[model samples]
Target: MVDFGTAEVTLEMVQASQIGMKALGAALAVGMTGIASAIAEQSIGSAAVGATAENRDVFGLALLLTVIPETIVIFGLVVALLILF
Candidate 1:
């Protein structure tokens, strides 16, 4: 068995670790939501394109549907901001 050296934990070290965790959390929140939004937009965009091609009248609705997934990214940004501040 290998022996591990003992290390003293200080208040500064604890605070630094907490800050790092907070930053990690904020990054995950934004990155995951952005990925999810991209996935959602992919399917919606394809369907929207098809619908718009079939009927020009549906273009407005299709546009709205395609854009709906973007809201998730905005929400992620808000969450990241909240986590950081």
Candidate 2:
């Protein structure tokens, strides 16, 4: 912006301001939770499946293993809330 003879600003300039790190915040939040879930599920699911495969009498073990991954989500939710608040 200028006086009466100011040159028009370009679209790139207009977009550059909003192109800051705001996007990274969401990406990191989501990425962390997603990674946590993936890691948890992989470990728990693999253990559960292995227990079930190793012994048909291991349903309790499998169940416990399956539920173990849930803790990650719970913990993540808590952390996310802490961060958000």
Candidate 3:
């Protein structure tokens, strides 16, 4: 085992920590956005189903609305990519 108690901080250590933070940020960005989108879609999906059930004509529109929340996930993916690379 290596002891870090008396070790001096180096540039490489700082860079490594920065990279780790970036990775953590990227993961958080993707995870939070995915959860948010999922929550949004859950309510929207239920409402859309009810609307579709009442009127068959609104089925297409409901489908489109349900898909709209998915864009948040896409945006999250972009942000994660930006952070990671």
Q: Pick the candidate with the highest lDDT.
A: 3
Model 1 local distance difference test score = 0.92
Worst 10-residue lDDT window, candidate 2: 17-26
**Tens digit of per-residue lDDT, candidate 2, span 1-85:** 5486767788988776545444445456657877887888887788788888989899897887777766766676666555544
Every candidate's lDDT: 0.92, 0.71, 0.95
TM-score of candidate 3 to 2 decimals: 0.89
**TM-score, per-candidate, Cα-based:** 0.89, 0.52, 0.89
Among all windows of 10 consecutive residues in model 1, the one with the lowest summed lDDT is 1-10
Runs in model 3 with CA error above 4 Å? 1-4
Model 2, runs deviating above 4 Å: 1-27
- In candidate 3, list every pair of residues with a backbone clash: none
Cα lDDT tens digits, model 3, 1-85, are: 9777988999999999999999999999999999999999999999999999999999999999999999999999999999887
